[model samples]
Structures are given as structure tokens and as C-alpha cells.
Target chain A: MHESPAVRGRRIKKSFGDVVALDGVDLDVAAGQVHGLVGPNGAGKTTLLGLLLGLAVADGGELEILGTPVGRTLAVPDGVAGFVDGPGLYPSLTARQNLSALASLRGYDAGRGVDDALEQVGLTDVADDRIRGFSLGMRQRLGLAAALLTRPRLLVLDEPANGLDPAGKHHVHRVITGLAADGVAVVLSSHRMDDLAALCSEVTVLATGRVVFSGPVTKLAAESGALDYRLLTSDTAAARRVALDTPGIRVPSGGDRVQRPDADVLVVRGAVPAVEELVVRLVRAEVAVRELAPVVAPLEAAFLALTGAVPTDEEVS
Target chain B: MTTTVTPPAVEARPAPVLRGYRFELVKLLSQWRIRVLLLACWIAPAGFVAAVSLQSVLPADTVFGRWMHATGWAGSLVVLDFSRSWALPLLTALVAGDVFAAEDRLGTWRHLLVAVRSPRRIFVSKGLASLTVLLLLVAGLAGSSIAGGLAAVGNHPLVGLDGHLLAPADAAGTVLLSWACVLAPTLAFAAIGLLGSVALGRSTMGLLMPALLAFALQLAQLLPLPVAVRLALPSHAFLAWRGLFTGPAQTGPLFIGLAVSLAWAVVATVAAYHLFLRRDFTDLTYDGSGRRVLVAGALPLAALVLLTFAVVTATTPAKGSGIERAKVEGSLATAYAHLYRMQTRELHRPDVTEAQLRATASCDKGGSRVADQGPGNDWRCVVSWHLPGATAVGTAIYQLDVTADGRYVADGDGPKEVNGYFQVRTSTGDAPNPLWQFDGNVDLLASTSKD
Candidate 1:
């Protein structure tokens, strides 16, 4: 028999008192897919993740996780494991003890999984150290290790890379991608567009407790209206003249202009097709197109256009 | 490419509740706070007994305090009595009050809730763990007190409240039973602490509220409430074991106290379980809005108190006239005889014979015409005894106070030459003997009259 989607929610609504944390939100996640959840702060990312993990029940609408429909009872579907609002841990316990405690609570022995998870998170060296002494990055890695102990088929993580160094981030990305390759459904919420762009096959953009966009990463960029680009060429004056002369491309005026006026670069704002047309003209005009890059990443530009504000650091995490 | 071996799935178990309980027990035992509290429980009582034994005079305010320095068994009884008043409740709260709130404090509620589907199961597991801890503390306190008492004072016959003497074995058993009797109320306090923990979501509130409630209830017992109302309070149950040390054991209060304690436990636990099942764990730091909890908790308590009041009002009769003359006369006569014999033997007096002394007593309740029964502070009794060198037989009027629970205090107004002490001639010598002398006061034994 074919397996159902790992998570399915239809117009799920959740409210706390007068504040609507989630409003008419719909989501679908399938096995072997990494679904990225992107939203500004207070956009209901954590609330939705909480619902998926069974830390809470949706106030209204249907939610199905791991093929089972969720009711009012607070319960995670089988094969679901993750953490929200950072992982909750006993500060006094060693990393190994924390994992062992969680394992024992679930009625299974840690066996070799504890060590394997620790090694996977690059925390094997400090496995015996109490969590009280762990840095934020170490704690986040330990949380991932804890989730791995369950051998979960569906993993939900909120800002799994919140405090990780570049190396730690690489390890986490590997583990998450590795899990997906093993047919696990992963739902990750993060503010880092690069990580999302790197790992997510599909992304869901939320704004004001509603979904603004959901599809492949390419669609998000394709749908964004226009973005500013930093252009560098062998001939700056020629590139600037060619760019301004190109149809549908405009050199931004006033305070919106590029900060480095003396440098051999031209900042232009226009749709991707228009920008492509300008690049074509530059090359044809023998003003070699040395470089062409959006000032903000396509994902981040789209996020800004969709959410109306640059994602704050706290929001990204 | 690398390959990994997948571990086998764990076997299914029949009792998930038991597993959850075991998990909770493990969590609690791993905490250093619990270990230290238990160690204090074991050692504090023994140290208290040792300190009290070193004092020349016994503490007379607490029940059995007068006998604390008398024998090991009595010392244990004194500690047991003191524990019932406050220490038992506090000890129970030490574990039960923290079991649930600690989850909130440590932000582990989300973790545990995600792993354990049913909140009710978690509640039960935590409750059971708290009970287990309480049992351990009680056992430690009891064991330590017994050991300390045995080492400090030698085994001796214990004096009962009704002037009856209990053998050494019976005294030991009675002491154990007294400790056992308080367990029912201690469990009730544990349930209350658990309820507070769930309702308040703070360990400090959970720990302090139950202890304060216990203290308040104990103070309420001092009021002249009807027996039924008194029986409803868990604190009253702590004193139910006092009946066991009487001439004929009063098991009525013992059984009633146990039932009342169980009732309170059931009510508190059920309420706590209900609240826990409905609680939202999404916000780990929610301090629980106090108004709703107050209403939830207050309704049940008000209903219970009103129900107790109604029952007590309907069933209880008016207080009896005063201490019964026959019961008091019999108790006083027997106690005086024992004291006189002890004095004569100690003084090496041989000429004074028990029959020749011929102690006689007459008692009345402040000149009332009503039947001499019940409890009062104004009962008067006159005793006439043969003096060693007096021309006429001496008469002394004793002012007596009787407590509702069947205890008495008596003060004698005799000639200055007699020094307000009961005097008798020794059997082996001509020296005069003083009876019932402790802290310059004469001790009298009183009995509860069966009406």
C-alpha cells in the first residue's frame, strides 16, 4: 500500500485568547521531502510546528499526521519526533543521560543509537558533559541527537541551525538531508534563506498567519515582482548607459542608488527578464559582463516582497 | 558507501502505566534535592530525640512530652506526636508538591507530553512517585526514631492515659501503630500537595500552600467544633491514634480518620487529574490564571466543609454535664495507689501498709445538679489520707481541669507543711514519701467515661 502524506492540514485555525496564532492555515508534507517553512516573527511558524508535534491541538480544522487524523487529544502521530521553541532539556543531566532518559521514557533502550546520534551531531566528544555547560550550538546539536534516537520517519525542527557554527551547520544539513534520503519526511522552520535554499525542495511562505506562497524554491523567485541587482562590468559607464537604455530596466535614483558611486558597478532594478535583456545588451555592446548578482538572494528578496520587511535575525532563527 | 545495522523494535508491554511510573520514579530519584531531603528525614528525628533526652526537664506542652525523658518507647511517642502536627505534612509536601511543578520549572512538560500521549497517565505516574517518596521518608523517620529511642533509653512499661500500664512489647507495637495511623493523613496531605502543584504550576507555591493549609486546619481543630466537623479535617486524623493508647483502644476515631483521609485523597486526586487532563501544555511557562484555579479548588472545599457542617449539626448532641464522678474517682484512686506504692517502695518504708492508708475521694463538678460527665476545667475533688504523725486525717481539695479528649490536670490546695505533694509513709522505714512529683507538680491520670 502507498503511504499517505506525512502531514496534512486543512484550514487549521488556532487561537490563544484574542490573538490568532494560526488562521486558516493549510499544509501538506510528503515522505522523502524536505519542506521549508519561512515566515516573519509571529507569523505562526512555531504554532504550526507545535501542532504537528502534538504539543498542542488545532482549535479548528482537520490535521492528519503520519496517516492518522488528529483529534482534540494532545498526541503526536507515530513516527513523529521534533522540538519547538528550542529543545527542552534537563540542564543538570549529561547529553547521554538526557538521550537515555528520553529513550527509556519511550519504552526502549538507547542501545547504540545514543552514541550514533551523538556522533552524527558531532557531540561525541562532549557526550559525558552536563548540558548546563554546553553552548547554545552544542545544545541545539544535542537536541537533534535526541530526535535521531527515535529513528523517526518524520522529523519536525524549529531553527535546527539557530546557534551552529559553519561546521556545525554543515553537520546538521548533512544529517537532515541524510534522513530525507532514507525516506523520512522533514519539516524545518528557519529564517536562514541560504539553509532553506540549500535544503528545501519546496518552501511555504507565511505572512500575517496566512500562507502567501507555497511551491518549489524556483517558483518563489519567479513570482517575486522585481529585485535590485548589483552589476559589475569591464566598462562601468557603458554598462550603466546600456542598463538605463534597456527597456523595463531603470537605474534607481535618490537614496535608493548604490552606496559605492566611485566603484565600477551599476545597481539596476527590474524583473529577471528585463535584467537578462540588459545583460544581453551589455555583452553585445562589448562591455564584458564581469558579474551579475541580486543584491539580496532571490529567496530573501521574495521573502521581503511577500512579508514586507527584511527577515530579522530572530525571525530567521 | 557505508551501511548501518537497524536495531530491532522494542517489545510491546502490557502496563504502560507501570513503565511511566517507573520513569517518574527514576527522574525523582536522580535529583540531588530529593536525596538530601530524604537524608534529613532519616537523621533529624534521631537527633531531636537525643537533644530532648539530654535536657533535665521534659517538654510538657506537646502530647507525651512529659514521658519523653522517661523511656525509649515514650521518647518515640513524643516524636511521633510532634511529627503528626507539622513535620509529616511538610515531609509529604517535599516530594508531592514538587513532582508536577518541577516539570514546569524545568520546561520538561513539552518533552514529556510529546512522548507520553495521555496526560492522565503522566499524572498517575507522578502521583504514585510522590507517594513512594512519602512512604520512604516515613519509613526513614520511623526507623531512625525507633533506633535512637532504643539506644538512648532502656525499654520500660509505658503509662497509658487512663492510668493503665502497658507492657514493653505492647508499648513498642503501640508506637508503631501511632506512626502507621498518621500515614492516612500524610497521604491526604500528599494529594493536596499534588493538587497545588498542578494548579499553581510553581514548586514554591505547591510546597508552601499545602503546608500552610495543614497548619490552618490544625489550628481550626482547636475550635469547639462538633466531632463530625473535626473528623473531616486531615489534621484531626493525626490525633486519632491517641485513642490507641487509652485503657480500651478507641478504634472508632481511628477507622473514621482513615476513611476521612482517604476521602480527602480521592477528592483532591480526582480534581488534580481532571485539571491535568484538560491543561494546555503549549506554553511551558503558563503560571495558571489564579482566578479559575481558585474557583475550581474553592468549590469543592466549600462543598466539603458545608457538608461536614450540616452532618455535624444534625447528628451531634449537646455537650455532657461534666467529668463523670465514678470514672474520675476510679482513675484517681487507681493512679494514687500506684504512685503511693512507688513512693513507699522508694523511701524504704515498711510500716505504711496499702490497706492502712485507706485513701478515699469524693468529686463534684462546680456544685452542678446535672450528671457528672463530659469535659470541663472546674471539677473539684477532695481526698482524705492517713498521715504518718498527724492527730487527725488530712483532707485536701484538688482543683481539676478536664479536656474534651479525656486528659486532666489537677492542682492540690493542702497545708504548707505538706508542700502540695501527695505524702505517704514508706513500708520499710519511718521517712515520709512524696508521690507524683515532677517539676514541683503532682500528676493525675484521667479517663474517658463511656456514656
Candidate 2:
């Protein structure tokens, strides 16, 4: 094992004057694992990121990075690297120069030079170009390249995949996985549960600065005892009757359905086995299933269940 | 919980400070605003010189006027020095204000702290880098002004504050010294800008506040402070070298100005450093994670500047009767004494004493008085003196004006009181008639006669 609870926070509380941003929150992230921090707007997701970045100090807490305590004079502990809100970059500098500047800032040799880091992030062709000309996706990649220059052992990224295209998101997911495989602990905060589901082995759900649930994503699914399913059918009435007739299943009431107008799909919230049995019964009833998918992850569903609404991308961004 | 100690081989290594600082310095230099500010320091002076030299397009008495007449070039360049007295300070603050503040604006404060473990080195290195840039600018501006003034004005005697002619060498010395004098006070302003940057974590107000304060001080100095108060001000250093153009030079104010400027620079730098050390690192950069950043020592600096100005003004010497007498008599006695000593050594012996000089001397080589001394004698004399030389002695002059308000007075030569008729004799010169005569100190055109 690399260490103890990789990032341990006990009864952490922070406030800006009278406004409580983080209210007595406790979280633990272990090494060799990717932990997702999911929360609604003003629920202290960004505040938690700031603490991880050593950018903000908590009012009351016993916090540690790599088992070493962080106090008043908090320097981003050794082996820690990430963005709280967004990466700070020199706009006039080229993509390569921005990474080089950061490389030098952290005193890292950045051995292969700016070109090498850009190459790793698939930004090599445009590396020499100024950051001012880069698109949002390109800027995100540039931020990633700069962070990688440090070869951080503990990476804290806030919505790292927000502006990333599918390819870029895949690249980030792979890069984060690779860092974790090398024992670099990853703490990522994002509203995109699919990205979190794909990248994190463990997820920490926060609601109003308090941790509602934290553990493996499987544990969150098992603990929630349910999943939201999105089903499409040619014979909607037949599929509905079959789903209703199935044992341990009931048709989601209007109150339980989360309508998706754009997708034209009805979200049926039910127990995991009940929803699973409904899918089987629909097949038996000769209902043509055009689409069958979970609305989102059990963790995301659990996140909404605890917080009572979907977390918009803006909340993390 | 038992803490596990990792073997030496398993422990992670930390980053070095030198590498981090160099990176920071490079980033600072690469900033467009900083580069432009530095470039201006070098280029502005040269541009001013070139423009000034090409001012006159036709033949004229004044060099700038002549250039303008001959070449159709504007005279704007020749007056750069006058304008730069205020402009250079503002320009210096522009770059200095952003020195530490840019990091905060960019959200790199915490990032830098992570890289460099000690805040002290970061503070020192950045402060030094900014100061180096400031010094370079001062040098560039000074060089440009001196060279430009010479090229524009050529070898002709430059105009003085009192409109007297100044020879080329004298003018060069004055301009160069004046430019150098600007540095002492500028250091304080530069430090203030840095202090602002560190506290506010932003450049906009950092640059503006100091320039504004400097302007305010200039205005405050105009209030009813004593001559000593104004003389003691660091701002007086701004006008100190102007005295070099005055006829028969005096350096009292110049030296006083230099000393005061030096004191301000030292005190400001020390205080700025001390505050920087105790300040919370969280305030060094702006994350805006919170509503506001609380700078540890900003109020103290503002207080110090205000207090310094207030104390200086309050205790400033008053220009009363005694002060007026000291200025007038002091200048007069010194000038006369100076000329008297020189002439006495040439005409007679060098060892002549005051008592001997006062004794009655014969016009025809006989030990006889000019007139029989009596209580009612109207021909009474009063003698004052003026000193001489550039190194130590200063130039002064006295005038004998017999106002209608004049009453009976006594003479030092004889024990007699006569109807006052202001007969003035200096330590060296012959006594002027009971009318008005100029010995040396007061410029007839410039002086305001009370009577």
C-alpha cells in the first residue's frame, strides 16, 4: 500500500464569514483508486477541490494529504497537482510555453521538454501556437499537459472533462486511469456521472457540504437498492402492462418519472431487481424494445436521490 | 493510529527553490505589460531626445526654438525632463504594481506556494527582480534625458530657475544629478507599488494609488508649511538640482533633499519586507475562493505615509521674523565677507582681523577718520558681509535702502547715534550713498522690497 487513508478529512468545516460553504464534512480517498466528488451547486464540490489544492484552508478540520497534516501555511503538498476551478495559464504564451512555464514553476525538469508533454496530450501539432488561439477543448488539454509535467502522484481535477470532446474525454479517462495504476491517487469532481462511472472506482456523494455516501461505486449501487431505467418500445402500452404485471415491479407514477423531452424517453425509477425483472417481462410479452438503458449511474441516481435534483455541468465548472 | 515510516528509497523527493524562482522570473519577464514597461524605459528617452533635437526649423535665439524654426520640428521633446519628473514615477509604478499582483489575478498564488515551500524566497526574489527593472529604467531615463538635452540644446547655456544662463558643463551636471535625485524618492514609490501588489493581489489599484498619493503630496507641500518643512521633504529633492542654475551657487537644499529621500527609501523597503513576512499566504494571490482577500499590512502603510506627511507638516519650521532675518543676513554677511577676504589678501595682507578692519583708516595714508565722530553725526555706517567659493562658501548680497520709515541708528565704528540714512558698507566693498545699492544676494528684478 502507498499509504493510509490517502486524503483524510475529519469534521472539516469552512465558511466565508457567515456563509457556510463546507459544513462539517468528512471524506477519505485511498491510494490506487479514483474517487469522484459529486454535488449540486453551492454544495461545496469546488470548496472541497480548493482544500485538496491547498488553495483554501478549512475553519475546523483534521486534514491530511498523504498522511501529512495541512495547517495554516499550506503549500500544495509534494506529489499533489490539480485545478480547483480552472487551470491558471498565461494567455499570451504559446501552448508549449505555458506548460514550460508551469514546469519551471514547480522546479520539475520537464525532461523531454514542452513538445513531449504536448505530444502526450495529443496537442503536439498545435503546441507552438499561442494559447489565446486555442479552443476550450485545446485549453483543457493544455492544462492537462501542464499538470502531467509535474508527474503528480495525487491529481485533483475539477470537471476535467467538461469541455473535452468524446476523443478528448477518452484520452483524459485513460490518462487518469494510467496515473492511478501507477499508484497516483486521483480525486476528480464532475457532473458527468458517465465520466465518473468510467473513471472512478469509488465515488463520494456530497449534499450541502455534507457527505451523504462515500465508498466503491458498486457499494453505492448496492446501498441505494435501486437504479433508474430508460426504456423505449414500439408497443408502449403492452410494455407498460408487462412491466406492471412483473413480480417485484410497479409502473413508475408521474411523481417518480423524470421526463426527458429532448430524448423523448421516460425515466422509470424503481428497485434494481424490480427494474431488471421488468425488462425481462417486456421481452416475454413480445414488446419490441428499441432502447433499454439506465438513465444514469446508480451513483448519479444516488447523488440525485440524496440531493433531490440533477447536478448541472455549471455546478462544477 | 500508528504512523508508518517509509524507507528512504520509498520516500518522494521535493522540488528545489532556485529552479522555481528562475521559472517565476522568466514568467514575469515574458508578461507583455512588464516587457512593454521595460521597453518604454529605454525607448522614451531616446525618442524625446530625437524629437527635441529636430524641433527648430528656422534660425532663432533659443536652441529648441531655433530647431523648430529651421526644421519645423516641435519643441515637445525639449521639455521631457520637466514632464518626466512626474511621469517616470507613474510609469515605474505600472510595472512594479503588477509584480506580485499578477500571480493572484492569474490564480497562480497557491500554485507558486506549492512549488516554492518558503514564502520568504518568493517575496525576496520577486521584489529584487522588480527593483532591478526599476533601476534599469532609471538609468535609461537618466541617460536619455542627459543625452537628449545636450543634443537638443547643444552647448548653449541652459536657462535656470531664475532665468540665468548655465554653461554646458554646469547644465549637464545639474540634469544628471537631478535624474539621479529622482531615484531616491522613486525607490519609495516602487516599494509602495510592490507592497500594494502583495496586499491587494491585483495591479490596477497597485499602480494607481502610489501615483495618486505622490500627486497629493505635491499639493500638500504647497500648504502653509515652514521653509524647513519643505526643505526637509523628499519631494524637495525634485527641485534640489534647480539651484545649480542660480548665479553664485548654494547647495544647502540639494544635500538636504538627498538625505531625506534616502531615509524614506530605506524605511519603506524595511517596512514592506516586514509586513510581507507576517502576511497570510492565502492573501498573496487572489483565488476569490472567498468574498474578499484580507491583506495583512495595507492599512499600516497608508497610515505611515499619511502620518509621515502630517508630522513633517506639523513640525515644519515657521517663516517668522527670525527666519527672514537669518536668510537675508546670513546670505548678505557671507557674500560680503567672501569678497572682502579675497580683496584684502590681494590688496593688503591675508591676516587682517575684524578689529583692525574696523579701526579708522586714513584715505591719504594717515590715521584719520572720514569725519569727526559726534553724537549727532549724520554719516553713520553699518557693515554686513557675503561669503564666496563653490566648494563651501555660498553667494549672498545686501542692499542699503533708506526707507522714509528709517529712524535714528548707531554705527559699529564710532559711539555715535545719527539720523538713520542706511549707509551700507560691506566687509570688503566701499560704503554706498544713503540711496539704494545692491551688494550681491537679492536679485533686483526678483526680490520683493517691503519698503
Candidate 3:
């Protein structure tokens, strides 16, 4: 559609004392898109999100939100709204009152958009109940509703899926997707690979305050070239023999990454063609295949490969 | 909030500060604790009035309590004076202490900033909201006190500090004016509470630190500091209105008190505002964590206060001993003359006007070695007064407890056979005498009294 990106942050540098939170990072989000930020702990995900929400100003960077350049002062353009480090909600206020308070603070008429926000987040039932007794999931949902009160063009959230149950998770997912459909740009940080795979078309992987990978979700999954395939067959010995005989396949006798608790299953590692050949050979050998699947999901494997890499012993003091 | 297919026409939005201020006001008013504090401010005074009215001994030890039964104005005055001790400081602290810290406590600074965007807007709005509530708090207590006092006690004359009987109307005026004057010091404390909140970033510290600082300043005020030094302290504004009811300009600390008051308020508020601006809301752990005592920030403020004290003390010399010999003489003789006239009228004796009784006093604090320039309970004055046609002068030794602000309680040592006893014989019955123990203020800080 060639729409101008809703957010463009370049070479952003933010530091707290001597701790380098973010060092020369870059990010972009287009309209009507869900952008996932995936990073390990202390990966500057929250710091980046804080900058997007105007909770902080970048010490050294250019950040444009909704096409307006952010200033040195703590501010983003008016249409940008969100929270980092979990949603900062007032426990003393009711769910509805919290939304109303945000609306009032945002210069909207009181109660003008509160009900819509609550209904959007599926919090209408507990709208009038004080949030002090609310579960973390409920508070997260309420925080999302408060963001909705802004009708933001660009939304930034940190760990939105934290503390959410299945039903609440789906509810929030639906809201995020609906907002993206409505042409809002959303940039949310999550440790959950499945959440990013489900909701995000574009994902940015950060490691040590630098972008290790940034592209489509499909591209992120493809970053890992090798696969750990779990193999099970009616004739296990026969299938193992056929898989061992197959080309371009390594079935490790002393297993590591492909290790499984199931004693009857054989673990193999190779490219997609090698695994396909092993499956075909198993059928040809008349060892009926019961199951053959990647032991770790592609996205998780890709995420771990991209962000979970530990520094060498020599790199540490 | 639905996004429209067509762009809506641009409309002027309210200033972000105004919007935030309105919400902050609503948020503050919505809290049950705030409402309860306000209710306590209003309702607690009535209980005090009732308690004082039911007691026969009267609160004679209090500054304005000796005439609690005589007039409602006395009750109001008692509340006005007593609130200064701790109630007003704590009250201002209770309102402003947590306004900023509560956001940090709740981790809602991000939530609020997402809406307001500018921390400056948040700071100004929250401060304005706190000030508004404080104004309401003071007004509520004042209104309730005046109303409760009048309803509990009858409107009668008030015994001024100078020992003159003030008519009920004028007394009420004086009481209300005193209460109104309390706002300056109240604002100064409120600013300190805000500074504590921003700098400390904890609700408990924000609430208690400003109050503790006020107490510390109050203790400093009592240290026989120079009159300029005393007047420069915000705490002294509480006692500044004492001399106003004497039918002249008794507010000697008026100008300096006001200047110091606004200076403290502005400086504290500005310091708080800067700290707020410097805050980094990058994490949810916002309240008093990750930050320790800012010695760089605090030392300058402390130095400013100390420098103000040093400059004023050095520049404005306190030449004489505490409560000048002339002021003590004038106050003792005036109080004695006024009370004697009343006593003579009740006893059906010839009235001796204040001028007819030529009174003189010689006072000293400590022994002859002491400077006698500051406040102390060690003050002793020998007062002599002559009757219109009496041959001999009557002398009495008076022990005085004088405060740094120049108000004193004097006890006269005289025989029961004279009018110096606790009570005096009148034609109708024994009437309470005002001469034996009397309260007076020596206007040492007054412009005309600089000696």
C-alpha cells in the first residue's frame, strides 16, 4: 500500500548512568501492521517501548511518531499511546473509572470512549468493580482498554501477554488484530514466540541492544537452517535403519538438541529435504510412520538461535 | 473509539495542563483518604469547641484559651493558634505529599504520561490540583471552626493580648484575618511536601519528611535567633498576627514573613518541578528505588536556607537583649492600667486611667551577665505604678515566659489584699482579676521598636 511508516526511530541511544540500555538501535512500524519485538531479558525491549510511548526521551536518536519528530522533551506525537514494563494502572479505580480517567487526561470528554474501550477488552462485566481485587490478567486487559481510550495511531506495549489466561489471551489477541485491521500500528514486546507468530506479520529480534534479525515472521522462522526432527514408526528399528540409510540425515546415537524422553523414538537432524527423504524411505521400507515432526517449533528454534545465544566463557569477566 | 473513514475537522483541544489538572483534581477528590481528611478538618473543630465549653477550668494555659467561655472568637483564635503547631503542617503535607509519589507508587506515571505526554503538564496540573484541595481544606476548617465556635459559645467581648476588651464583631474579624494569614505558611509547607514527594519518590517519606522539616524549622525558630532571622522562617508566620488586634500595626513580621513565605514556596515548588522533569519513567519500579539521597540536590537547598538565616542575622543586628526594656515596661504598664480600670469600675472606686497611673518597668533575662536579647522563661521584670494622688509607688516582681516571637505570659507577685490576687472583690461579688496573670506581646520586630 506504500503507506508512510507510523513510526521510524533511527540510531536511538539511551543510557542510564553507566548501564547501556539501548545503543544505536533502529526501528520502523507501518500503518495497519502488528510489529513484534522479541528479545531476551535486559535486551532494551522495554527501553525502546518507553521511548515509543514518550515515557522517556532518547538521549541520542531521531524518533518520528505518526510522522512528527519527537523532541528532546518527554513526548511523542499526540496520536501515539501505550505503556511499558506492564501496564501502569491505578488499582484504586474501577476498570471503567480507569478508562474514564485516561480519557479525561487525554483531553477527551469524560466517559466519551470509556465504554467502548471496556467492551473492546471484554471488561464490561467488571467495569464498575475496583481493580484492586483484579487479577493480573484483568489488570492487563484493563490496561489495554485504557490504551484504546486514546484511539492511538501507534501503540506500544511491553509484555502484553504476561499473566493472561487462554480466554483472556485470545481476547487481547483479537483486540490487537482488530486494531491492526483498523489501520493502527502496534509494536508489542513479548517473550512468547507463539504470540509473535500468531499476531505479528513483522518481527524484530534484539540481542544485547542490537537488532540481530528484522523481517517477516516467515523470514524469522527461516533464520534457522537445521531442524531437530522427532521420528516415530510402527517398526522403530526398521524406520531407524531406513532413516540412517537416507542421505543428508544425522541420527545422533549420543543425542543432545534432539534428545527426547520417549525411549522408542529416534531423533534426527538435517535440512527439510533430508527429513523428507527419510520419511519417504520409511514408507518404502514398509515401516509405517506414526509421527515425524520437528521436536522444537520453527519459530521457537529461530528465536532461540537469534536471541538465546550465550556469550563464551572468555567473553565474560 | 472508532476511527472514521473521513477525517474529522480539526478542533481546538484544551491545553494539556488544564486537562491534566482537571483529571488530577478529580483523582485527588475521588480518594477516600482525601475526603476523610477534609471531613476531619471540618468536624474535628466542633468537638474541640464542645470539649473546651464543657470544662470549667478553661484552657488557661493556651494562648487564647483563658477567655474560652467569654466569647466564640476565643475558640476560633485557639484553633487558629493551635493548628500552627502541627495540624496545619501535617494537613498541608497530607494533601500534597503523595500527589506525585502516588503515581510512582502505583506505577501509573507511565499511564498518566501516555495521556498527558509532557511531564511538565503533569507536574503543573498535579501541583495546581494539590493547591486547590489545600485551599479547600483550609477554607473548610476555617468555616467550620467559626461556625462551630459561634454555635457552641455566645458572642461576647474578647480580651486582646494588650488586655483591652475587643468587641465581638472586631474580635471575629481578627480571628478570621489570622486564619487567612495562615495560608502563606501553609503554602510553604505544601511546597515542601511536593519537593519531598518528587525528590524522595515515596508516599510515606513525602508525607512525613515535609512535616518533619517544618518541625525542625520550628525548633530553629525558637533558638533566640535575630528578629529578622525569626521573621524569615516560615513557621514564624503562625505567630505573626498576634499584634494585629492591638488597634495598630502589630504585624511586625508581616513584610519579611510574606517575602520569606513566597520565597520558600516558590523555591521548593521549583525544585520539585525540576526533579519531576528529571525523572525517568523508563521502568515500573518508580517509587524511591534506583535513586538514593541526592546530596548534590539537597545540599544546595540546605545551604540556601542556612545562607538566608546567616545573611539576615548578620545584616539585621539584634542590638538589645530579648524583648527590649522599654517594650516590657510599656506592655506591663498598659496591661496593668487596663485591668485596674476595669477592677476599679467593678468595685465602685474612682477610675484610674492608663495615663493617671504612671507605670515603669525594669526587666532582665538571666543574671546581669546575660545579654537579655532573646526569648527565655528566665525573664524577670520589676514593675512600679503610682496612683493619681498616692504618695508612694507600688512595686511588684513579675516572672515572664517569653517566646522568640515576642509573646509572653507574665505572672505578678502581689498580695491577696490588693487587686493582684487571682480574684478581686467587686461591689456585687468576687470577679476574676486579669492583673495577676496576663498575656502580652512585646513587638520587638516592629519598625518603630528598632533600638
lDDT by residue for model 2 (A219-255), tens: 7767654565677776666776677677775445641
Winning model by TM-score:
3
Q: Quote each prediction's TM-score.
A: 0.82, 0.71, 0.89
Model 3 residue A80 CA deviation in Å: 1.7
Worst 10 residues of 1 chain A by lDDT: A254-263
Error of 3 at A224 (Å): 2.5
Order of the predicted models by DockQ, top scorer first: 3, 1, 2
Report the candidate with higher TM-score, 2 versus 3. Answer: 3
Please state the error at residue A167 of candidate 2 in Å.
Answer: 1.9
* TM-scores of chain B alone in all candidate structures, in the order given: 0.78, 0.57, 0.87
Instruction: Report model 1's TM-score to 2 decimal places.
Output: 0.82
Query: Against the true structure, whose DockQ is highest?
Result: 3
Candidate 3 residue lDDT tens string, B198-305 = 877864776786689778988886777667566657777777777776645565466556667777888788878877887777855566632433452455456666
Angstrom error of the Cα, residue B450, model 3: value is 11
lDDT, residue B363, model 2: 13
Q: Of models 1 and 2, which has the larger TM-score?
A: 1
Question: Which CAPRI level is candidate 2?
Answer: acceptable
lDDT (CA) for every model shown?
0.74, 0.58, 0.77
TM-score between predicted and true chain B, model 2: 0.57
Candidate 3, CAPRI quality class derived from DockQ: acceptable
